[model samples]
Target: MTVDNIYDVVIVGSGAAGLTAAITAKKNGLSVVVLEKAPVFGGTTAFSGGVAWIPGNPHFQDRPDAEGGTRVDRAAVHDYMRHEAGNKYDAAFVDAYLDYGPKMLRFMERETEVEFTPSLYPDYHPEAPGGAQIGRSVTAAAYDGRRLGKEFKRLRQPLKTITFMGMMFNSSNNDLKHFFNFTRSPVSAAYVAKRLAVHIAHLARYGRGVQLTSGNALAARLAKSALDLGIEIVTEAPVAELLHQDGRVGGVVASIDGQRREIRAARGVVLAAGGFARDLARIKALYPHVREGGEHFTPVPEGNTGDGIALGERAGGHLSQGLPNSAAWMPVSKVPFPGGAIAFPHLVDRYKPGFIMVNPAGRRFVNESHSYHDVGAAMIETCRGLGRTEAWLIADHRTIRKYGIGFVKPYPMPLGPHIRNGYLRRGKTIQDLARQIGVDPETLAKEVETYNDSARRGEDRQFGRGSSAFNRYLGDANHKPNPNVAPVENGPFYALHIVMGDLGTFPGLVTDTQARVLDGDGTPIPGLYAAGNDAASIMGGAYPGAGITIGPAMTFGYVAGLSLAGRIADHRAGQAAE
Candidate 1:
């Protein structure tokens, strides 16, 4: 029962990538160990909305005809991603990913007990010329961490509550329908009854149910499988340094319970310790405009502070600059959580009509309904010469009363205490509001008038506001003329200041297609690999689909595991032959 001094593979950060690597290596009969920096396993993966974009998946092809049964063309997916990334993506890495992603998913499905289902959610770039509606996203079925027995304590449950059985349980428009129904009709009663019955059945039998969302489900299932394979996950063990011999990784120096321990990796070591979002100083240094003071908006975990990147750099690894483009950006309301903050789901759906956002010069900018990336890019662009980066969401009485602006209930309340105390402004007229927010009152009034005219005509000629399907999908369906093209007609307006907030920093150690960490010369460091946010992202600068970070993390980790273990076996055989 003595603890082995060396393992075949040592994986740092027991998130999706680390766990996936451990499981794959163990399956190949290689002794593996995982070290997690946080108190629990499953880093940010558990908190994400899981939707892996797996092109050419078989399950999609096996779906019913009405559900659109057919494999996604590899070429179409590649072209779509290239166009989405604006040709900034690494062609070789992306091609390798597209070729192997489906195969990796299939391998995990066939070899392990993890189960997955296709999601009907369209690609985020569904309208990008080559984008399609169905067959693009896949999610794991809910797994009972309880199945891991003692290992359950080591796994991290989602920081938020998750819905079971692919049920319309997460933040979706369906939540609104359910709320209205619960308050107004008996149909809601019947629907609740059926949903409750299904939950009960799943709890009594499988110990878990599917979720309408995919991220949480995927993390739980991966954790369960890793535990079942006897992979040892040591929590609160942060890898501080990589042990090397002749320019190759030999082991790792890890901190466990404040005590340092050296765990040798006879075969290799993998770094998946995530990114530097929580580190305020690093963020300001790298991305100055996106400051960390004012109102709270980031949903990222506090522990994600670039431990992996630091360790890799200490070991002479190269880092990528534009990789920060992989960061997750969002427009969040000023709702305060205990240690962090979260975007109120209602605000996203509510802030459509009677509101328009403007830059410091008081001019309408990009489409208000564009994805957060485009929004963040626009914010950065608008504030290019302003000496600071900031924007304002202008809304009037109509929007306040109709959709409920803040996180507080009944919505019409003028900027809750959180917003008012932090970064929000209110006034009786557009000019007054502009003055208070430090914008040109005349320009602000003119922008509002122009927007109102467009709203009256049921069109946005400036930005094609309602043109994209993705924009309209998240728009207020109750609006007339167009769901996304509403004007600022009502007076007694309010404007809330907004800055670009990110989930985590995405720039990190550069890695090859096999997830092997590379050195300054652009050569892979033998016996060293990285995955997830800890490594240079495979998506290059674009966020193509939901769970892009976790999906590639898991995929590349699987590949790294197989490659490393095979090398170990080959080494042993060669030694025997000698």
Candidate 2:
């Protein structure tokens, strides 16, 4: 398709946010074009779990005959999330998001074929002062990407191999028992056998199946909507600069196949390109500790290099500070050699009772089983105290043999690297392992003795770790006294070095509630807007729940789309009246 004139709106980045904005603009009767730098459509959104945290959504309302008497009111959800975020979340932004998120979700559900279901996953801060047990996250229903035909290849898939319509392992004793029973039950066994047969038959009949799970489903839905709306998506089209006319964004200069081309936006231009997670130099400059010693692992594609922020900065956009706090850092097992190089988050639940994590000083820091966000914060603090950012995961041979520790059997997949490489350090005793890892053997031995004494007493007085329900939820079920608080007694200890890493940088071009790109003076740049990671996160420094990024990205994209269309309509009306 050839275009001679400017469209109503031009969107940069075809990820969840960008595509959502383009489709919203089209629905508002505005001409729109989406430019993506990658050969695909969905950016990080395609690689995520696709869970949107929308408190007080209609989907959470009690259904007739539902087992639980749990009722999630608007006020309750708002208060709960606010409290969960330590009341530091932007109140107005959260309010606006909660108010419009349901409507926006319904619009996608009705207008497009994007089916979704409320996830049974508990909130990350479930045991927080006012957190709820469930009904905060939503996931897209499986979609047949074949519906998009050729457009299917342009969509990104999840980085992890998540199970589709299978029971989620909650990393708790009760949950594990339930899982085992479900697999062993006669009816469940028969159902699984039938499902396997059906899958085999589908594979035989067609080269691919239509069951979209996790992030893939979400990406497929968004891609389908863009295609259905006739929104032109130019892949490998990276925006080089924002064209300005009289101090206002009027068009964009983009590089397509190494050729520079100019495209004008009659109404406005929206920037949704993701953050710079893979930019090693920028990361090191911003986070010195992480660069020097912290572990950095990201499953994001190599193309994510801060192109959106660069283009906007070139056009005089203002960036926000505190970028160091925006990343998702956690301990990860390194990938092994011979074609296996993927790093998986060292989930504490998977560690069982035989292991524990400690700092370079040979002392237990935060609860080793905490969420990555919490662990990341702890890592940062540990680094600050030690004048360096480095930690180690200590475990025993029993833990390795039982849970497969780092060397997950699926060779060439996410955890295969640990098995292939010597990253998994092993020793016959804790002291020997500590010496091998360059840590003080006496300090590590003392720390372990103190921890084992606490475990023997079935209490964690120092950290109060095993006290929380969430903590015990991820503990080993077989432990008699307590699942979470266990002694690392068995010998043949191992240690793996860990560094802090993040999914992407958070802080970027500042935008308002409407997602209009603002200047250094805190004023909106005319005909210019930003969304997704390219803009300052609306949640500030706190992560409220899953899908926090994608939720606001879609919400603000809708807002920007409407805002652009309204501007074009007003302009035409003014001209016609004159």
Candidate 3:
């Protein structure tokens, strides 16, 4: 915690990646310290789904499904990565990750409070070669926040949008069915009542709900593991530069409590402090600012401004280029909420029934029911053509009452506020809605007519909306015919603007299979490594399913630990020889 303090491993960013590296390094008998730039621990991982899409996971070993099929195999994992990565696939990286990924998960389970379940979430590309129809993604078992005690206050909270009334929303089928069945079914009503009773009791005690899932639970588990191992986690400590010793990376100079502090690393420094989503200038250099004239916002913590990328650059680390996306992009909507304007990532709502996306030309472009990354990427390409800077999501009163559009809550909740805030536009006719949103009236009218006809037939001949398992998984489960297909045929329609939002920045420092940061000539920067968004992703430009980000993050963090131990030993041996 002081200048000149030295540790065997110094990890920047206290998210899943950084903490995993810290834990694994400690497991290897290395003294480790984690420095966080934000005011609290748990970077974006705390606000995430907390699912790790690691195939060959042991949790699925004896797990059986309602349909009686096991979920994973090593071969299937290989097929998925190969197919998803396409031309950008890295065989050695995939092989290395596959070797260590499950090992890391098992180690965490055996050694830490981090428990995982072979969750029923489907793959994003379920039909891909070797992809599991059910999925290999595992959700973090819910942790009671009170166990951290006062330290729980130091854990970053999940995004307000991901939670409901300050309580983390469980996304499992049974959990969701309870919420969706609020007024319709007695079973759902009872489930909600029981959940509310527990939540209320928790709120009275912990000040936050007791049930922690998603990223919050993931962060808490990792943080608790570090705490258990006597690892020091220093928040509000920003690494200013990667220090060098004899032309090799040694440690870091950071700013803590507004004072410059030098922390010497005896072995190596791992960069996992997230990516450059908040660094608008930096992001614009790689991606065109298509959101400038329209709606665009990121739900990631504002503290994420590419500190790791910047420090690595100063230390001669090479930033990667031409990723599938420079960030984990998603469509975001800005809507006025109780306290202020909240930028909400339109995840489940877009893929649900009764919604359509149109660019400035009032013509439908991408498949609305596709994965968020795909939809956002398509929006980027759509914007590039003919200077179209805006897009809109349209839905009918029925969809709004059932699923909620943008920030507007379901029916029974008054729609007046959203309409007043301009987050939603209401129109009695399709042509009127088009004019209200500045779209060509006739073109939008035609698009609507065609879409309505397709919905009636339970098919989208244009985009194949309900075709994939992943797509249907996100759609209305109880809907008839195709869950993703629904007619927007009623009057009093709603619309919200779309923009490029991302889970986090991508295309970070180029690294080898060992998770060591690379140089311009494709050499590892000695004493330097990266994981999570801090390093170029192993998944190339594709998002295969849930937890892809966190899965590789923890895997390579473990790899970084193992690699650092070897690198340090080799360096020591070389010194002894000298």
Candidate 4:
């Protein structure tokens, strides 16, 4: 098929936001095309957990009594936002997300074939205003790749940390439990039995299983729906330069197979390129501590190296800063998975009983059981003048065996491999383990004593670790009093060094609530738009829930489509009158 000379909407980056923008614009009566830089479609969203935090969704409001679906209160949400972002809160931006998010979601569901199932995962700050313990986070239902026929293999697979045997994929709680806890319960056994049977049959027929869920499912479903609608997706076409007309962005100069081609757009170009995480230069500029054992810990994909940001800025778009950090941080640990080295985000690992995080000084700084973002923020804050860049996560025998610590599998799973690889440190005594990790042995012993006492009492007085609802949700349910605390007085302890791993870039192009890119002077640059990490988060850099990132990305992408499409409609009306 020949590439079109002009499109109504030319979307840069085929991640959730770009795909969403292309889909919405196409449905809204605009000829759309998605430009993907990577050979495969779907950016980091395909590798993500795919929980979208969309409060006040119509799907949840309709179900009411559904597990993760329920009506959300607007006032409560406002309260949470105000408290989270304080005076820096973008009320109009957030209001735009809240007002249009549900409509966008409903529109996609009705018009497109994409499906979302309510996820039982709680918000990062469930105690915050309007936070729903459940309901808000919605995950994409499993997608049968077989439906895509020959296109199934073209879809990007899940990250190695997510799959088993590099062929099986799980996207939700029940699915993961069935796969990971295969021999634990009868239900799990049955689930695995069917999965194995299907795996064997599929391996024989297709060499890979087609049961896709979570982020992979979401991206695949969007791609399938877009393909079905005849939207031309040009892969391996990276946007080199945005076409400009009198200080306005009209299209993009894309690199297609090592050759540069100018792609035109009638309405505008939406910059949804992932982020600047992979760019070492940007990372050094953002976090001055980059050289100090930081990027060695970062597992972000190398593709997201600020292409969108550079294009937007060259077009006079301004970058937003000063909310939290330049990027959304997550406590990450590296481990060797099947295909390659995997950066496993440490969320559940921190909240479970018998795990504690300590700095190089061997002192517990933040509540280990808190949100991953919060923990990472604390890690950064704690290391400001402490001469330490990373923290160590100490796990006792029970924590490592019962609930795997980071990359370490449970009791039945051997840790010898991990220990041998130096991904984990083990010792019969706390002092010995401390020496292995370069922490003060005396201070380590004291920290353990203090933590063990708190665990026995079922309370964390130092940092209030297990006091929150969110903490308890991620904690071990079997534990009494506090599910987040357990005595660390067991022999054969394990320790893993944790680093501040960012999920996606937090701050990017500054845009108005309409998803129009704003200039350095705070003026909206015509024909320019941005969403997802390519745009400064509408939440002003504070994470609220599981899918908060994806929710806004898709919503604003929807908003950008509607806005630009309307502009197209208006232009046509004016031309007709003329």
| Candidate 3 local lDDT, residue 576 | 12
**Candidate 4 local accuracy as lDDT?**
0.79
lDDT of 2 at 565: 70
Q: Give candidate 2 misplaced runs (Cα > 4 Å).
A: 1-5, 63-88, 127-130, 160-211, 291-295, 322-324, 337-341, 347-354, 385-388, 406-420, 456-459, 472-483, 567-578
- In candidate 2, how many Å is residue 426 off? 2.5
Leading candidate by lDDT: 3
* TM-score-based ranking: 3, 4, 2, 1
Q: What's the distance in Å from true for residue 240, model 2?
A: 0.5
lDDT of 3 by residue, 1-578 (tens): 54337998899999999999999889888998899988899999998888898876776756643423343465777888889888778777776666677778878898888888777767888887877776478898889887887788999988887666787875465566567667778987788888889988888977788689878888999999898898989998888888888878888998887988888888899999888888877776766644344335789888889999888888888788877667777888766678776678877788888899999889899889888888888888887745445589999888888877766777567898778878789889889999899988899999988988988888888899999988888788799799899988987887898877889876889987778888898888889999999898888878888888999999888888878777322221322110
> Candidate 3, which segments miss by more than 4 Å at Cα?
1-4, 62-75, 289-295, 337-340, 386-388, 567-578
lDDT tens digits, residue span 1-578, model 1: 13356898999887778888888888888999888888887787776655566666656875433423345465787788777766456766766666556666877787786667766656666788678765666776656455666665555555442222323354344544443344345886577667768767755765554332345556667777786787778888878889986768989988876878888998899988877777666676666454423322455666888888888888878778754364666555444556655443222532365667788789988788776666766777777755666677778766655554544322323455745465446788999999988899999998888888878877887877777666666676667768777767677787776656665556778987778888899887888888888887766667676557766877788778877877322221322110
Query: Candidate 4 on 386-488: residue-level lDDT in tens?
Result: 4456899998886687777776766567888988888989999999999999989999999999888877898887888777777877676657988888888
Error of 4 at 341 (Å): 3.8
For model 2, residues 512-538, the per-residue Cα lDDT tens digits are 767788888877789898888888876
Error of 1 at 487 (Å): 3.8
From the highest lDDT down, the ranking of the candidates is: 3, 4, 1, 2
Q: Please report, as a residue range, the 10-residue window in candidate 1 with the lowest summed lDDT.
A: 569-578
Write down the lDDT of every candidate, Cα atoms only: 0.68, 0.68, 0.82, 0.79
